[model samples]
Target: MTDAYYDFSPLYRSAVGFDRMARLLEAAQRNGQENGWPPYNIESTGESTYQIEVAVAGFKADELSIEARENQLTVAGRKAANDAGDSTERTFLHRGLAERDFERRFQLADYVVVKGADLANGLLTIDLARELPEALKPRQIEINQPKPTLEGKSAKSNKAA
Candidate 1:
């Protein structure tokens, strides 16, 4: 039988010591696939800003979490009892709403960071900003004037003197 191996080290090369860690996490994700949970979108807010909106109908602000460590953004959700003693048992004719717990991760760029998160009208919006490093920015080099050549004037006079 042939051996099956998966390598995912390239995804987290920008982060320190996270290459191997990401590889393990990716392997685990492939091995144990969970239920397909929520609907989301990633929008380019501007040149340096991005926003991720998830449709979390039943989840509240406390039930969801947005985490950014190294070069990865993870969105997780947990179902908890409502404050007004709501029922955990959801009955649906078509059964489309996602009430199960889930964790979704996205690989971010080198300078990308999460700004904040907001929940409104059954939507959770997470904002991200990309901050480039000073050294990585473009810098213009100054062109200096060329020095004068002495060969045009001094050779014959200095030898005769």
Candidate 2:
């Protein structure tokens, strides 16, 4: 399939890190379009802040796990059947939403961190902030005063002689 945003031709001769990001985007696009599983949305909070919200109903806080490793953000959920003491039979006539389990990953920029997560009304919201490295940020360079000209130096030496 033709890439929607990435051009492999230019990336072939480029650096390795960009190639990896391209590959990651490709994988994400494929997985994102493949199974319309729990829908999600990504929005930019500011210049370096962002948020990703997913519909995760019937999932508790303990049933979810979020991890950030090697510039990858992974969100996973596993709902285990409760089988202790309490016994109740419940049936749903029209069951549509998924409450099973799922794993979703997002490739993050350097120094980007997962700030926090909040679950409300069946939506799982994950916040992220991109904190650029010191070296990567722009800095002002102080200019020094110019040294005495060659002509001035020569005149001073002649006066001394």
TM-score of 2: 0.72
User: Candidate 2 residues 4-111, lDDT tens each?
Assistant: 654555664676667776667566766755465677899998998999998888888889888998788878889987777758876899988777788887778879
Q: What lDDT does model 2 reach?
A: 0.82
lDDT of 1 by residue, 70-137 (tens): 68788988988455776576667897776778787777878999999999999999999999898989
lDDT agreement of model 1 with the native: 0.80
Top candidate when judged by lDDT against the true structure = 2
Model 1 scores a TM of 0.66
Error of 1 at 157 (Å): 17
Computed on alpha carbons, the lDDT of every model, listed in order, comes to 0.80, 0.82
Could you estimate the TM-score for every candidate? 0.66, 0.72
Q: After superposition, how far is residue 65 of candidate 2 from its true place, in Å?
A: 0.7
